[model samples]
Target: MSTGLGWRDGRAVLSAVHGRRVHEREVVPGVEVGWLLGGPRRCIGAWLEGQDERTPCPHHAVIAADGAAVQCASCQSVDRGLALARDQILDDGRTYRLYLAWFGEGLLKVGLTAEQRGTSRLLEQGALAWTFAARGALPAVRRAELTVAASGLARERFKSRVKPDHWWEHGDVDHRRALLTDARVRAHELLRGHGVELLADHPVTDHVGVFGLTDGAPDVYRAVEALADGAVLAGRLRPPIGRHLLLDQPDDGTPLLLDTRLLTGWTLAPAAGRPSAGLALSERVRPAEPDTQEALF
Candidate 1:
């Protein structure tokens, strides 16, 4: 059954984010029905959380644009703290791998995840190119991330809409790999200079097969700025690039790149004909104009 909610374990499910493009019989059954109906028949309800709780509150309460659930202010506070402490905890309590992820030309980010997650974490972030720079205990990985950031090698995060479509098309994988390799070499030197132990060699991976890298221009269904709460979004869903969704809006033959994060704290239901609920005044923000430039590097 489709619940308007797409989040699971604090991450958006790949199928829900990609819409009809990703087919996993286990998660989404009757693919044809979903495609024919524009997307999964689901609805978004309230956002609920509890103080120091590992699970969401069962109240199913609505939330604000900033993701604060008015009905559960205490939970919201706890959620914020948990977000800050995420790096300190891992599900399996195993070694963590530190990575250098490259986006458009020169865009890089330093991140750490459980060693067992493999490429899953990278995929979730929609990294155009990435490589594992080091692996070690949590403290070591944390230190590596701090050192990389302090050395000006990369940032901790990037804007969701900053990614330009051109890089995906005209981007050269070999060139990117070369850049990553060079960065890796420099990173190792920097770590050693800081007296940090070098745990392992970097492992590189490209997202071409997973994200469908192409030179063809994407179809624009609508601009992200035009979306409003209770605005029923329906159409052919394209593979996600980073956290953005390329939706082919049926009302008008336009393609739009929507940030998946925007769907995080809302109640959503399948768009049968029109939206049945409205967003709170505080939840609405004017969307930004779509980027028309070549690249955001």
Candidate 2:
């Protein structure tokens, strides 16, 4: 069985695959979210939202550990062909909204989503704060995204690997909101020439609290950059950031971050207990270097 993590409606969900069948479970806070990896990474299979529920790969494809995509060649064509594409030209007449999502300081990006989805996209991307810039047909709203991206008002893409370093900023939400506000203002100004209907009076929505970051980041924590077979991850899960799970074990004083992307391609078994080996973790968060320590000290 292959089990993976995902976000739905501002909550964490665990989906498992056995043969061709898929099952889902909601992962709530204060619950010990535990799982043991079965073996090397394999293709998690295809996810075709509008067409069908996810299905196992007909070939049961095996993939590399650090590949850019979790799906194999066949699944990519069928699932990612046009879904969530900004370059596609479609006149299906669905309204779209352009938004600015702040991941951290200097990590703002421009994107568009269906008007009906509201802030779902922002929630799924682990945005700290977000705001809408405009609304219109798909093409027009996408154009707004490109305009802002080209103007350097916001990024067109972001890297997830750097997110954990700033995970401690929950207590400093005022700074996050300020960063989003400035980026949104620049984005709005950049899109003034576009034909889309500009949005106004919409305050930047903050998710630090929603992410269980209101209590502030822990003084120190560990992170998992990748996963291996037999790794055990068990702890009280905080609100996950997209697919990122922050597992805390107060008893041992070790907090860990495991990116669920690594969970995508492998089967997961419930661990009987915290194995002595447990999960391999990266370095701990170090305190800020004492202001570069001048010669006079």
Candidate 3:
């Protein structure tokens, strides 16, 4: 709750806004992560970024957390009006790179990111294995993304709530690699005359070590209950996958999964001496699919 900013560099850096300025802190694995839900969730405020300078919300408005977004209406307008990834604006004069990300078996999806961000976007999205496809202006890259999705080479969307179940491999690495490589190859062929610069063949980048998908992962885990005021979460955390936080409950050794979206706008307090984190753990069941209108991060 100390920061209202989103994750940067995958799970390592947690960005925040304080004193009307943005600050970033590194999040290391095995670190004790503790916080109390002190107050009702507030709007995270608006980040109105223009071409030359970034702007914060002047209103500093607040709202309830029952809705999907943690932003006020004014802030959302700015985000939806210009955010390139939202597919509202095109040709913002920014270079973009297309990528194919594999979440699980048959969960490969095509997406694009600004070239400057490199692989952090993939890490943020918790892609188990991924590779770059092409680089070009936003319009071209976006076109390729849609084309791939349309051709059934790879879809444009996947239910992220199901990603944790795919972090660990069902069997061997070769199978996953083959799947990703095959998609990348077919996608490249489809995009041959699309006017984007095709990237050379590269090995699929696996995130097992950074995401702790091997020894540190749980064969089965419990999902944390809904967010409400006064809820306290305390644990040792592994490197987060996208917005998902994997926690080790020190007292009971329960492996808990917290979807950060549940806590994005909640104000939190230090829970240093709390004997136990009074969490209502739930049996792991697949969550309902997200709304089709929801924008991809």
Best by lDDT: 2
Better of 2 and 3 by lDDT: 2
lDDT of each: 0.54, 0.74, 0.72
Best of the two (1, 2) by TM-score: 2
Answer with 1 or 2, whichever has the higher lDDT. Answer: 2
Expressed as tens digits, the lDDT of each residue in 1-297 for candidate 2 is 554676667666778777767788887777876777767687766667554567677777888765546777787666643455735446557899888888776677888888877677788778878888889998788778888898877887788886666666543767776777777777778878788998866788888888877765677777776677777767887777777777887577678877777777877777755742445577666457566558666
**lDDT (Cα, tens digit) per residue for candidate 3, span 126-211:** 77788998999988998899999999878888776667766645345677678888888899889989979988677788776667
Q: Which ten residues in a row have the lowest lDDT in candidate 1?
A: 29-38
Ordered from best to worst lDDT, the candidate numbers read: 2, 3, 1
Clashes of each: 16, 1, 0
lDDT of 2: 0.74
What local lDDT does model 2 show for residue 261?
75
Candidate 1, position 120, lDDT: 66
Candidate 1 scores a C-alpha RMSD against the true structure in Å of: 8.2
lDDT of 2 at 297: 64
